[model samples]
Each structure stands twice: as structure tokens, then as C-alpha cells.
Target: MPITNADVVAVFSEIADLLEIEGANPFRVRAYRNAARMLGELGRSVRTMVDRPEELDALPGIGPDLAGKIVEVVTTGSCALLQRLRKELPPVITELLKIPGLGPKRVRTLHRELGIETLAQLRQAAEQGRVQSVHGFGAKSERQILEATGRLLQQERRYKWADMEPVAQALLADLHATPGVHRAVAAGSLRRGRETVGDLDLLVTAENPGTVMDRLTASEDIQRVLEQGVTRSSVVLKSGLQVDLRAVAPASFGAAWLYFTGSKAHNIALRKLAQDKDLKLNEYGLYRGKQRIAGDTETAVYKALGLPFIEPELREDRGEIEAARSGALPRLLQLTDLRGDLHAHTKDSDGHDPIEAMAEAARAHRLHYLAITDHSKRLALVHGLDADGLSRQIDRIDEINASLRDFVLLKGVEVDILEDGSLDLPDAILGRLDLVVGAVHSGFDLSRDKQTDRLLRAMDHRCFSILAHPTGRLINERPPCDIDLPRVVRKARERGCFLELNAHPARLDLSDAACRIAKSEGVLVSINSDAHSRLQFDSLRFGVSQARRGWLETGDVLNTRTLGQLRSLLAATMARGVGQ
Candidate 1:
């Protein structure tokens, strides 16, 4: 099996986790963590870069040592350092890190203070009331730990869509190459642009179904074949992801695609609509008294039921049917509609690339402009800029912009929003920037009202142009802070500011539901890549997908505006703070 970027990411991440638990050098641990992140968010294939040592070495945060290990893992499907660490540790020590509140520091504390290394051991300690006695843990902490352990145990494994993409693409390529196959594509939640997917549903049209099944089962990636049949087959990959493949006749390919690409609720609604029309719908075709009427195309299928073609991302039964029937479905936002990315970083903060490299990359991606929103000094670990540093950066951006032709580089900062509803940077410093991207880096445990108010106060700042990653959630790694997002969206409208639909796969904050709320309240959202590296510009496509899922149109996205229009809107926001 070919080693995927996700495979390499997992190996590197494990190495970092184990190193952290072993109390190795903090910088050493951070190196592995950073490399894992860069590769995970990279748009291209790391596996294909094995032969180019210089290219691999050039990746941000990947020095000679780390680059060698990446090449090792990609070519060998294993890393000796990771293997050795696994053997030296308690084997299950890494499992403890999955619990909600347990970071490496907390895991180290648990392992050293109570000899708890496995989930079972940790759970027993929490249950027996021993964990609360630890230095930082209390009764409430112990209770929460127990609850988190139980939740982890019961949760079904779901892979992020970004992680599953390469695997899915590889499988599609294999199926397409199979002699008898004519068409192959993935369906189900993966097609719906869902953030996380539980399993894959693949549809294929082939001359010989048996040959396609043979090709699938013979793959090196398969862990085991669950079942094999003439028309259908199921297998589990070594990565623990289950895949189901169905071979449909060419005539019914589109019907099968629609049936399998379902949100079960969406399918049920469609079926009811078909029934009301006295038509029959199924995997085979839409029929009238045993005569096939529509099946060869999804558009044909929807048309037969007197509705227009619905985008797959909006097939969530979230009023889509009613909207379609009333000719009110949104012309959803597309990747092409995005004109620029407003939130990004450079080496000035914790980002990997230099300012010039980042700007060139944005231009390469065809963006008319890019914003350099590095961290503020409050985030000391990233060596965030102070007032003087930001002032210098503003000057540097102006010089760079002067030298460039059509592309402009905007000066900006991802300033921290302090717990008391104040910004980390002074008003004087903030006033100099083209825009301000406010973020909450700590204190996620605040009450809903407090969190909402915190955001409201930050938006009230004169220079606040956008709220970056509004909820401060990191997908599976962290829960969204308790905040009333609707109120925050309303506040943005009143303040003439915008909310960011942060496009990082790990933090797709201002989630679909939040985007819908923003649209309803007439608050335009900026779909930003939040790119730490140039390669991360690809993340904007995923952000666009999320926006479509939220029923966002071109007009609902702030970044779709040209640079000139964006400047006018931003100026209005800057002036609104003075009067309001």
C-alpha cells in the first residue's frame, strides 16, 4: 500500500505525543507537532516528494532530521523512532491523550503521580475518587474525566474528510484503472462535504461486476474483506475505515449515486415527494407503473419530481426541499466566487513561511489580495509581534505592495481577545492596520453569556474588522466554547464587522449552522484559509463547501468582493466604531 500523507501525519503525531509524555525537550516535541500540521494541511502529496530531498527539507518546520524521518515513514510505511518509543512506553500511554481535558502535561502528571497510563487505569482512578487528589485536578475535574472517558469509549470512530480524501482518490484511481470499469466515484457523506465521515460508499459502472470486485479485494490497502458479491462488496482498510463498493448498470448509475449519496432523512423526504406525485423512486430508477421515467441522471430524477437539481452539500433535509419547491434555493457560494483570503500568517509569528513567500503564494492561487494576520505579543510562544513589531510590519507590507503589480498585501494582525472583553494590542497600534482579526486563544471555559459578551466587546473595537474562528473549536480535539453565536452574529451586523468561516480543516469554526445564522441576520462572512503556509491556500475550497452547506450565496460571503469594494466596507467598519 502507498503511504498517504495522513499515514505520515499519524506517525509524526504519535512520535510527538510519546516524546511529550517522556518529557523530552519541548522544542523537539514542537518540531514534530509542527511538521505533522504542515503535512496534514498541505494541498499536494508528500508521498510523491520522497525522491526530492531538498523539496522535503524546504517544508516549513521540517529540518534535516525531521525530513529524513518523513521520507523514512513514507517509503518504509513505518518509522524506527516511533516503533522504539511505542516499545519503551506503557503501550497504551497514548490512549490517555484522547480524553477531553488531558493534554501531554496532564497525562505526564497522571502517569507520574498515580501510575495511570491506560484508559482503564485512568477511568478507575477517576471513578475511585483518587484523581481529584492530584495537584491540578479537583472533584469536578475527576468527574469530568470520568465522563470524558466514558464518551470516548462509546464514540464511533469517524475520520475527518480531509484525511479521507487521498485514500478515496487512490481507490477511485484504482477502480478507474480496472479493465472492466467505466466510471467510479465516491458518494454518501463524503460527497456532501461533511466535516467527518464514518464510512465510504463508492459507486461504479463496469462491464464486468465480478472483475471490479476482484480488483477491490486484491488491493494492498485492504485489511480484510467483509463480503464479496456480484454487484456489491465491502472491506475495511488498514486505517480502520470501512468502504462499501456497489457496481451499478450504466443505465441506473445516476439513480444509484443519488440513493447512496443520501442523508437518510433527505432520501426519505424525496421518497415522500415521489409518492405524492404518484411516481416510484429507488436505487434502480424513478418509475411510473414499472416503466422507467428517470434514472440516468440526478437532474432527471429531481426534474421528474418537479424540482430543480439540488447541490449535494445542501441535501441535509434542512428546508432544502421546501426551498427547491418554491424556487427559493440559494445560488450557493462556489470556490470561484472567493476573491481573496483575509486571514493568514507568516514567520513574523508562529507561522512557517516568510512574508514574501506567503504573498507570492496568494498571487499564485489567483487571489487579488492577501492579508498578513500574524499573532499579537500575547501569544508569546509564537513570538507574536508587539506594537513596534506591528508598526514595522505595516511599513514592510507597504514596501512589498509597492513593488508588486496587481496583487496587494494588506497589513493585519490576528490579535488576541483578552478574557475581560479587551484586545491584547493597544488602540493606537490596531488603528494602523488595514484590518484586525480578533481571536480568543485561552479561557474557553467561560460561561455562554460571558463568552458571547467577550466577543461582542471585541467587535466594538474600532479596528476590529473580522472575528477569526469565532467559536475557538478544533474539531475532534476540542469542543466549541459555550457562546451564543446568534447574538455574536447580530453584534457583527450592528458593528459593521464580519465573522470568519475559518477554512482550516482542523478549525472550520463559524460552522454551517453558525453561517446560516449569520446570513439570516444579514452579517456577511469572510471565508478565510487561516493559512499558516502557502500550501494551505487549498483550504479555502473546504471553507467554500462549508459555506454552501450553510446555504450561503455569493453575496453572503465578504471575501467575494473585489479589493476596492472590500476596502470601502472595511473603512465603514473602522469609522462605525467611532460613532457607535
Candidate 2:
């Protein structure tokens, strides 16, 4: 099996987790964590650069030691340091880290103070009321730990779409280069742009099935070939994502894609339509019994069925059929339609890049405008802005704008929505910006009514323009706080404030369902990268994928507007217009 970037990253992450539990050097533990993050965000597989390890050393956080470890894990399935740590600590020590209330420090405390290591042990500690005896844990903490353990036990393994993206692209590029290959495309939940995916399916048309199958089995990332046949093969990647490759004749390519690129509900609907017309639709082709017809392309199949072609993203059978028949299907939002980003941070806060560099990067991405909404003072850990700091940043933004052509930086702040529903920064400072993004950085444990009311109160604030990562989810890491999302969306519409679909892979908040609800409520959604650095701006495409899955159109996204339009929109959120 070929070592995948994800595999190497997992090794580093596990080392970091185990070392933290062992109370190893903090900087040493940090190095492993940073390397894992760097590898995850890398645009190409680390395996491709294995021959020349210097290229790996040249990456952002990768030093000689980390580079060797990368080559070590990629060359061999595991690393020696991780092996040593496993011997030194309980093998299940890392499992404690998955609980919601447990970080490295707390996990260490649990292991050292209570001799707790596995999920079972931790659960016993929490349940028996012994966990609260630890220095930092309390009765409430014990309850939270117990709940978190239960949730983790019931969860299934899933991969974020962003995590799977680079790997899939690399494999597709390799397949396209295979000798005598006519075409190859990845389909299934991935093609439909699901936020998380279980596996990948590749459909190919080629002259030599044997050549494609051989290449797939020989790939370094293949952990094992579960099954291999003349035209179909399935393998599990080193990252545990299953991939199935199917080679078909060019004539049935479209039919094969339709059959495979399905939402089961959507496919059933299509088949029912075909049956009504005395036709049969399957992987081979749509037929009037024994004679294949309308199978050369997706457009041909849709045309024969008397329905407009639906984009793969909308193949979820969510009223798309009726819309297609009525010619009411959306011209879904595309990445190119985004004019700028409204929620981003810089070095002034916890971000890695400075203002000018971030603006230049945005210009490089062809964005016409960008907003620098660094965190406000309540997030003291990030050295978030006080009034004076925000003022300085605003003046700096003006200075940067003077140096650019066709690109501008709008001063903004991701002001924290406090527990009692107040803005973290004073209105005097917030009122001066092009926009203000309100977010919930803490208080994720509030009751549904309290949480919904908290947000509703924040929306009543005159400077509130957009809600950032509304659900506050971290994918597989944390669950969303209890809140009436529907009420929040309706209130945002009435107040004219937009909701954000944060593009960051960890928190693709205001999820597809929320996006759809926002659209139905006639509220606007802003697909922002929430980028902390210039490289993170590249994550905008992930946000676009999520918006497409939500059936959002260009007109439904607030940031797709020109700078003038966006400014006019934000102006409505100011004090003077609260009653307008």
C-alpha cells in the first residue's frame, strides 16, 4: 500500500497526542501538531516528493526531523517514536482526547491523577463521580465528560471533503495519465459535494481495463485490494477511505455515471419516471427493451426523460425533479461568482498573515474586495483588538487600499457575541467599519432557548452584519450547540443581517440544511473562507461546494455583490437604520 498524506499526518497527530499525555516537552509536542496541520493543508501528496526529501523539508513547519519522520512513515507504515510512545503510555490514552471537554492538559490530568486511560475507564471515573475530584474538573465537568464519551462511542468514522480533496485530485491526475485512457472522473457523494464522504468511486472509459486495474493495485496508497476483476476493482487506501474503480465502454459512460453518481432517492425517482414511459434506465443505458437509447451523455439522458439536466450537487432528490420540470432549477452559485470575502482575520489577531500580504493574496485570487475581521478583545488569548488597536488597523487598511488598484480592504471585526447577548466591542468602534461579523466563540453549552435568545439579541444590535459559523461545529470533533436555527435564520432575514457558511474544513457551519433554510426564508448567506492566513483563502472553494449543495444561487450570497453593493447592504445594519 502506498502511504498517503493523511497516513503520515495521522502518525504525527498520534505522536503529538501521546507525547502530550506523557507530559513531554511542549515545544516538541507542538512541532508534531504543526506538521500534521501543514500536511493536511498541503495541495499535493507528500509521497510525490519522497525521492527528494529536501522539498519536504522546505515546507512551512517541516524541519529536518519532521521531514525524516514523514519519509519514515510513508516508507514504512508507522513511525518508531510513535511506537515508543505507545509502549510508554496506554494504547487507548489517545481515545480520551476525543471527549469534548478534554484537551491535552486535561487528558494528562485524567491519566496521571486517576490512572484513567481508556474510554471505559474515563467513563467509569465520570459516572462514579470521581472525575470531579481532579483539580480543574467539577460536577458539571464530570457530566459533560460522561456525555461526550457516550457520543464518541456511538459515532462513525467519516472524512471531511477537504481532507479527501487533494488525495482524490492526485489519483485522478494519475489515472488520466494512464496509457490508452479515454476519460476518468470521480463520482458518488463526492461529485454531489457532500460535506463529508465515506469513500470514492471512479468511473473510467479506457481501451485497456487491465492497464487501469494494474495501475490502481500498484499504487503506493493502496493498503490492499479487496477485490479485482477485469473491469471493476476495489481497494482501501492507507487513510482508510475505500475507492472503487470501474472501467466501462465509452458508449455507456453517461449511463454508468448516472447510475453511480446518485443520491439513492434521486435515482429511484429517475427510474420511476423511466418506468412510467415504458423505458428502463440502468448502468448499461436507457432502453426501450433490447435497444439502447439516450445514453451517450448526461444531457442526453435528461433530455430523453423530458427534464432539464440537474447539476450533480442537486442530485439529492429534494424537490429537484419538480423544479427541473417547471424550469425553476437554480443557476447554482459558482466559485467565480464570488466578488470578495467578508470574514477573515490577520496578524492583528491570531492570524498568521499581515494585512497588506492578505490583501495582495486576495487580489491574487482575483477577489475585488476583502474584509479584515480580526477577533475582538473578548478573545484575549488571540490578543484580539481593543478600541485603539482596531483604530490603528482601520487606518492601516486605508493606507493599504491607497496602494492597490481594483482591490480594496474593508476594516472589520469578528466581535464576540457575549454570554448575555452584548457585543464584545463598544458600538463606537463597530460603527466605523465597512462591516461587523458577530460570532459565538464560547458559551456553546447554553440551553436551546438561551442560545437562540442570545443570538436573537445579538441580531438586534445595530452593528451586527453577519453571523460567523453560526452552528459552531468542528466536524467530527464537536457537536453544534443547542439553538433554534430556524428562529435565528428568520430573525436574520428580518434584521437584514446575513449568515456565514465558514469555508474552513473544521467548521463548515450554517450547514447545507441551514443554507437551504436561509434561502427559503429569503435571507442571504455569505460564503467566507474565515481565513487566518493567505493560503487559507484557497479554502473558499470548499465553501462554494457547500453552498452549491445547499442549492444557493449567486444572488443568494451576500458577498457575490460588488463593493458598492456590499457597503450599501452593511450600512443598513448600522444604528440609524435599525428602525428603517
Candidate 3:
């Protein structure tokens, strides 16, 4: 199989982490990190651009050397420098960096001071209070480390949905194209749009099970054939993703899909429901004493059970069964329902694209409006905008808006909520913009009450519109902060402010449960792309998936409204007795 963009990005990222732990040159470390980000932001796969040296070199962060390394990784599946670094550092040391509270410097400190190289050793040190004695880590930080380590230890290895999607798509396409295969789909957690998937459950309806199995086993992507049977087969992909392929008869395809696509709890409840109806439910079909009542289609199966067809994303046994039976199933939010993206960056910040390009791309993506919410000055590394810079950008947006047709670029800033709960930009400038998106970029380790209070104070600020990326999390990289989310959601509702579901692959914060909380509190959510580049507008699909999982409807989303209606809603957040 060909190398994917994710593959190259992963290697480069790991190299950056390993190099950081090794105390390599700071610039060298930044180069690797920047290259990884560049590759990740590139819409096209680096694999496709490998042959075009000029194209690779033209990327914002890529130099000739890094470009060559990217090409090397794509062509050869590995890099010699990364391999040498891996050899120099124990593999376990890199794994420590994954624990939330532990960064490269802290990992180095633990290794150098306590000779800790593994989670177990780190745990031992924490328990023995050795961690508190480290220069930077105190008692509270030590406790956090222990807690984070415990979570990491219990967690199973899983691949991010973004990373596994291409693999699943390519595999399903290949399977469906097989001569005897009639239909194919990736089921299980993947179907549910879980943040990460442990393994792939594939369902196939085939005319000849033998031929289908033969083709699957013969695929080049198969690193190992775990099993091969007439009705079922299992294989391990080159990337270590295990796939279980079940060949079903056309008549049983629906039942098979349901059984495999299930959350185990959901299936158990469904089976019980079938049992109550004096029927037996299995992968083959629903049976009433050897007579099949339903199996051919999912709708038939659901109808026979006296329940509406529960969307795959809602089949989590989270009262969906009861809701379906009572006709309370929500009209789940769809991608088409999103009218705009409330949070996006431009070249004025760390973003790769200019404001015009980002707006055009969002328009091309079918959005009616987009907010140019570039970072504020507190984020020095991104060269975030100060008051003067934001004023200039606002004027530029106005100039651009005058020329646009059918779309509007909302003047906005991703203003940082300082550690003390104050806005980074002055009220003079913030008042000039259409909206302000307050974010917590630093001071993540504050106590729960303090963090919640900090956010509440920021929401009290007259200009605060949406709380961007609520519960500061970076997917698998960082755990969410210690703030009380229920309290935060309630506060947002009271303040007439909204929260953002950042759609960036790295930071899909304000998680499914958070979205549900916001929904119940009548606090609308902005399913924003948080796009740093034109291509990133595509990330809205992931945000939409998360929203559907949270049971959000079009009305629950802030950006789903038309421009005129949206402005009315935004104006409410700025109302504070007409005071600064």
C-alpha cells in the first residue's frame, strides 16, 4: 500500500519528541515540529507530492533538507535519522511524553534525576514522593502526574479517527470492488465516529465467500493473516490495525451490520427487546421459531422491534432505545446545517493561508459566513495580533467584505483570556469587532475552582462571544483541564455567550458530552473549523460527527443560523448594561 500523509507526519512528530528529550538543538527541534504541522495542514497527501520536489519545497515550513526527508519517509517508509534517535533513546522514554503532565523537559528531568524510563518507574517515584523533589514538579504536580499515569496505563492503544479514515476508506473500496463482493462497510467504533478506533470491524455481503476471502488475504496491505475461514477472516494491516472481515449472505447483511456496528450495551438491550417480543435476534436475522421476521434491511429490523431506526451514532445505549420508542429521537445535526465557521485563523497569526484565501475556501466549502478569529498578542510564538494589528485587520476585512458577494467575513479575534481572567486586547479594539472568541492558551494546571472562575470572569467581559475550545484538550496529546464543565456550560447560558466545538483534528474540544450539556443548558455551540489553512475547513465534518454524537440538532448550533439571525444572537453576548 502507498504511504499516507498521516504516516509521514507521525514519524516526523515522533522524531521531534525524541529529539526534544535528547536535548537537541532548539531550532532543529522546531524544524521537525514545524514540518509535521506543515504536512498535517497540507490537503493533499505528501505521498502524492513526493515526486514533485518543487511542490514539496514550496510548502511554508519545508526547506530542501526537510522536504528530502519527507520524500525519503514516503518512499522508504522510514527515516535513518529518526531510527538513530530511537536507538539513542529508550522507546519507553518517548511513551512517557504521552502522559498529560509530562512534556519533554519533564521527562528528561525524571530520567536524569530519578533514572525513570517507564511508567511503572514513574509511578514508583510519584508514590515515593520522589517526583515532588524534582526542580519543577511540586506535590500537586506530582499528584497530577500519578493521576495522568494511571489513566495512561489503563488506556488501550488506539488510532485517531483522522488517521484511520483513509485506511478504512481504501480497504472498504477494495473490498467492495472484489468480483464476488456485493457490499462492504466499516462498522463498530468507526461507524460511531469515536475519537479513536481500536480495530476495524468490516461487514461484507458476497456471492462467493471463498473468492472474497481469497482477495482479502491476498491484499498487499495485510501484514499478517490472523485467520481465514469460509464465512469470516481476520487480518492485521501493516500499521498494526487489526481487521475482522465477515462475509455475510445478502439476506443477513442488515443483521450482520447491526451486530457488528453495535456498542455492546446497545446490542444487549436490543436483544432483550427482541426477546420480549417473543423473538430471537442474532447476526443472521430476527427469528420467531425458525421464521425470519426481519433481516433484509436495517429499517425493517428496527421497525420489527417497534422502534424507529436509531442512527448509528446514537446507538450508544444512552437512552436512545427509549427515545426511539417514544418518538423523541432528535433530528440530529447534519453537515449541511452548518451555515458558517465562527473560529478561523489567517496568515496574520500562525495560520498558513491569508484571510482572503481562507474566506474563499470556506465559501467553496458551502459556508455562508466565516469569522477571521486570529490569535491575540498573548500567544507570542504565533506572532498573535496586538491592538494595532487587529485594527488593521478589521479594516482589511471591511475592504474585503465590500467586494464579496453571497458571503460575509465576520471581523473577529481569538482573544486570549489572560491567566487572571482579563481580555488580552483592550476594550477599545474588542468593541470594534463583530465578536470576540476568548480562549485559555496557558495556565492549564490551575485548580478546578480557579479555572472555572477564570472562564466565568472572562464570559462576564462585555465583548466575550464564544468560549473557544472549551476544556482545553489536544485529543490524545493532552488531557482536558481541571475546570468544572457543567458549571461552565451553565455560566455560558446565563451570560448569553456560546461555546465552540473546535473542528481541528488536534483539538476537537467541548466533547460530545459537553455539547450535550450545552444543549440542555440552552447554550448554543459553534461547530467551528478553527481552520489554520484553507484545507482545514474540511475538519468541520469531524466536528459535525461529534455534534451528532452529542445529539445536537440544527437549532442547538449557533453557526447554523443565517447571517442576519446570527448577528442578533451575537449581539446578546455583548449586552452588559452598555458598559465596558
Which should have the higher TM-score, number 2 or number 3? 3
Scored by lDDT, model 3 comes in at 0.88
lDDT of 3 by residue, 440-556 (tens): 999998999999999989988988999999889897888788999999999888888899998777787878888889999999999998878887788899899989989999999
TM-score, one value per model: 0.97, 0.92, 0.94
Clashes counted in candidate 1 amount to: 0
Ranking by TM-score: 1, 3, 2
**What shift in Å separates residue 349 of candidate 1 from its native position after superposition?**
0.5
What C-alpha lDDT values do all the predictions have? 0.91, 0.87, 0.88
Model 2 worst lDDT window (10 residues): 571-580
**What is candidate 2's lDDT per residue for 1-580, written digit by digit as tens?**
4567777888999999988878889999988987787676555678889899889877766789888989898888799998998999876788888788788889888888999988988888888999999999999889988888887777777788887766677788889889999998989988988888888989899999889999988887778899899899999986678999999998899988998999889999999999999999998789998898888788889888999899999999999999999999999999999999998888899776789888988888899999999999999978899999999999999988898898989989999999888899888888889888999999898999999999889888888889999989998888898999999999998888889999888788878888999999999999998877766777889899999889999999999999999888888766433520
lDDT of 1 by residue, 1-580 (tens): 5788999999999999999999999999988999999999999898888899999988888888988998898888889999899997865788898887789989989999999988888889988999999999999889989988888778888888888878888889889999978899999999998988999999999999999999999988789999999999999998889999999998898889999999899999999999998988999999998999999989999999999999999999999999999999999998989889999999899888888999999988989999999999999988999999999999999888889999999889999999988999998989888899999999998999999999898889888899999999988778899998878888999999999999999888878889999999999999999999988999998899899999999999999999999999999999998421
Candidate 2 Cα deviation (angstroms), residue 463: 1.1
The TM-score that candidate 2 achieves is 0.92
Best candidate (score: TM-score): 1
Candidate 1's error at 365, in angstroms?
0.3
Question: What lDDT score is found at residue 279 in candidate 1?
Answer: 88
Q: Which parts of model 3 are misplaced by more than 4 Å?
A: 51-55, 112-115, 125-142, 217-225, 576-580
